[model samples]
Target: MLKIRIIPTILFNNFKLVKGISFDSWRTVGSIMQAVKIYNLREVDELIVMDISATNNKSKVDLDLVNEIANETFMPLTVGGGIKSIEDVSNLLEAGADKVSINTSTFNNDFFVKEASKMFGRQCIVASVDYKIIDKEIVIFSNSGKVSQKVKFIDHIKKMEALGAGEIILTSINLDGTMKGYDIETLSKASANVEIPIIASGGAGKLKDFTDAVKNTDVSALAAASIYHFTNTTPRDVKIYLNSEKIPVRIN
Candidate 1:
């Protein structure tokens, strides 16, 4: 069954779980290990742990944290941060991460994606791209969306796909944290152009947002933070709502 995956995205800064806007002003939420326990009970489809400050902070992969969380959780896990080479990918996978997400490295290291795909297989290599609307068109952003690369969203997605990225996690810098809804218009553009699975990120305020993203954009999955972290919602609830809407979703 082609079910929509309800994933909880956890951001870490300075080795602490935090949440913020456009990837700044991060406020520590909890211990990464503690967050993992909560999500395990919720039975989420998958969990994404990203150390947004690692690149800027110049820290290595939190292998101890990764090992702890992986040991506790039963769902699929993806870890990203300061991943610069194949050795980093190998270390993360060996530490028990199911997948690795690459962003900033792709611009200068185009071959990293292909090399990682060859080493870990395409399914384990996720190309995560951040974008913001410029001149009414979605443009790619790097350095945590602080600078615009000015690359059209569609062009970037095509390049990542051609580079052997197994899947793409597309986030809208403009809509991120707004809770207005997803950038479905932009998401649809990527879906129409790419055959790989697209994970829609940002601007999810309620359950309806998930339904709308999948039904409207045909994105393979929907990811959100504030909606799941600060609200009373759970992945199970999102799946139940999507199922009610006649969308396939795994229920725990």
Candidate 2:
């Protein structure tokens, strides 16, 4: 079995790190730089820094800020938000991002994924999908979960894969920051549909939550913001617990 990754997600808004529940009611966490520096020491597998407001603000992720954060982040860095054009991807990569996570822009121009993949290779692209459950059905949302795409969840992920996205960051808008646990049924189904790596995000509350997803789903990585920020649980602690459960993880 391939080693599972424990990733820390940084939700950045107005130059500060924040965490929110159900993709709303965001609250400031701390200095973005400070958080990155701390994660540098935490033995995390990779780091995802998202400019949560950039899409709504009609602006691209601040390149200068990403350059600054990337300088401090020692692990593989994935940056997302308001990414539209090919140049945006190029600028981000040149600024130090190891991978670029594209969300809202893809809704308007999914061909952008194919173009980026062809230019930079699929491995450089991470297609981010945010969805919410409505009337007992999974519905896709974009623009930071404000607008509903009204598309089928499984079809959307399969589309991303077909478009050459190297991986998918599946985030449940309903479960984000709730710390209730991952939407396991949805994740398991999504995993069974895709061949590439899937980074399961949202609703990670405890150690067992991490273990459960690994044991039950084919997800390659587990990502959370609230558990690491609100609780004392660190990525290392989660890895130790997963290791105790006989799950494969990289320990250093």
TM-score against truth, every candidate: 0.96, 0.98
Work out candidate 1's RMSD over C-alphas.
Answer: 1.2
* Candidate 2 residue-wise lDDT at 1: 58
Each model's C-alpha lDDT?
0.86, 0.93
> Model 1: runs farther than 4 Å from truth?
none
- Cα displacement (angstroms), candidate 1, residue 167, comes to 0.7
Query: Among these predicted structures, which one has the highest lDDT?
Result: 2
Per candidate, the number of residue pairs that clash is: 0, 0
lDDT by residue for model 2 over 1-252, one digit each (tens)? 578999999999999899999989999989999989899977579999999998999988888998998888778999999999999999999999999999988889959999999999999999999998888999999999999996688989999999999999999999998899999999999999999999999999999999999989999999999999999999999999999999999888
Native-structure RMSD, model 2: 0.9
Off by over 4 Å in 2: none
